[model samples]
Target: MAKKQDNTITWDTFSEGLWRENPVFVMLLGMCPVLAVTNSAINALAMGIATLFVLLASGTLISLLRNSIPKQVRIATYIVIIATFVTIVDYTIQAISLDLYNALGAFIQLIVANCMILGRAEAYSSRNPPLKSIVNATGMGLGFTLALLCLGVVREILGAGSLFGIDLFGPRFEPWVVMVLPAGGFLVLGAWLLLFEWLKQRKSETELNPASES
Candidate 1:
């Protein structure tokens, strides 16, 4: 019984963040970056990729040293490891493109302070194996990215009448300027949450009365 209870599957760890415990939509852990950079699809994509890299790297390292880390300073130690990855990502972005680096700005460095990363480090990775930790981190990162994209798409389309900086609608379309503003972030997020809840309820109803549908 002990053995069975203690065991975990790698795939389970990876899939949990997809829907069951999504960092952005479900868990709502890292809102700062999500709301700040999601005005455009490209910005959201850049932020997502940068976050994914640091999360996987830090989670792997932290899991590898879980047994050795002193309980007295585990939080501090995790911060250092996370900061190291953030630094790497920061410089890499700067080297790649000055414009992108300027766009993402301090949010890249602020990944160290993102509760989602640290939460996963302490809650899942620290207790799991390196492979499991990386998988879980990847799942969570992907979930966050997907959520960002959802908002980015809607805002970019409505606010700028474009996607990825290319105009989808001709000059006749009037963009909703508010969609690009900070308030648009809240509005979009709230709409998503409402949709998620509605779908969840529909699923629940289907499950509760499966015979009727058949």
Candidate 2:
């Protein structure tokens, strides 16, 4: 997990979420929806975009009203605002696709409690201007979406031999059934985290090795 930022540049706030402090891979927030809903690429994309909408919308509101809300009740206020947006998102998703809505289940409503959203609202948005808050939220949301897509794409291809329901492996390829199961989420996510760590270490070593870049 990352520390709550009281002060930082806009770029730092935004970029940190994409890599150093990703909500899922690094910070590990909102695992329920991540594990439960990412059985396919489309599902993962839907969930990610839904979360992004809620975060960005609520962050803007929290930043604009930061001065009016008393510190003592700010958490509750933030929840209310987030819940409002979540409801809107939930209904919107339902209208667009009932199957997606059912697949997401309570996880959509649960977005209101996602620590990543509330964390930004309290730690960064509340103390910053609306523009900065939106930028930071955008970063966090996109990072979250990217992480989701990573698992989703891997699972869909291996588990079902398809991406978004289009057959990539043709009819002959055998699918890994376990890849679409609940355990698959954990396995894939863990694999991705390890892969990222290895790559990060390699990049650091490459940068530090004096003879290579000269």
Candidate 3:
């Protein structure tokens, strides 16, 4: 049998989810929305925050019910919980502003389908206490938000000469219309992945060959 993890280890697990094993930049899970909704920084931020709220709430709830839930139906139960939260977020956004809600479109509802939420419920929440699950969910959600923000910044700057709806570049700036297109999303994401891989390799090499050790 696998050894049980100490509760203290939850912090490490939680922090790693935010950056080291980020679902978007590192693990590369839930790329569809990341690419689709990042045309503007506002949309990206809205989506990220919505996802974060759902993830935290669902994780905590799932962890609380872990023992009581039958193992066979746990996945289904978790999905239902997650879907309910997503629906709440969806309506909340719609009520706040129809434009923003329309900007996000079906992607808001699709949060229920995001693998990160379900994966967390099964892999982390089901195995840990409610507090730890909340921490983990927050970390993972933040990581996802960070990645989306990065993509949104890149796309918005190149496509619209703006950042979060604020014009940074003047009229002289000629926006690369393609940056707002589907092809541009893929290109930007691909380049970001390559950059991440390169940095990770460099970090690994530096750690392996530190001057003090040498």
Stretches off by above 4 angstroms in model 2 are 1-10, 209-214
lDDT of each: 0.89, 0.89, 0.89
TM-scores, all models, native as reference: 0.93, 0.90, 0.93
Count the clashes in each prediction: 0, 0, 0
Cα lDDT of model 2 by residue, 1-214, tens digit: 3455555455777887787778899888888888888999999999999999999999999999999999999999999999999999999999999998998898899898788888878887888888878888899899999999999999999999999999998999999999999999999999998998898778877786745632
**Pairs with backbone N, CA or C atoms under 3 Å apart (clashes), candidate 2:** none
- Could you give candidate 1's per-residue lDDT for residues 1-214 as a string of tens digits? 0122243565767777877788898888899999999999999999999999989999999999999999999999999999999999999999999999898889999988999999988887778888777878899899889888999999999999999999999999999999999999999999999999999788878796746532
Clashes of 2: 0
TM-score of decoy 3: 0.93
Model 2, position 131: C-alpha lDDT score: 83
Runs in model 1 lying further than 4 Å from the true structure = 1-10, 209-214
**Residue lDDT tens for model 3, 41-152:** 9999999999999999999999999999998898899999999999999999999999999999999999999998888788888998888778878899999998999999
Residue 98 C-alpha lDDT in model 1: 93
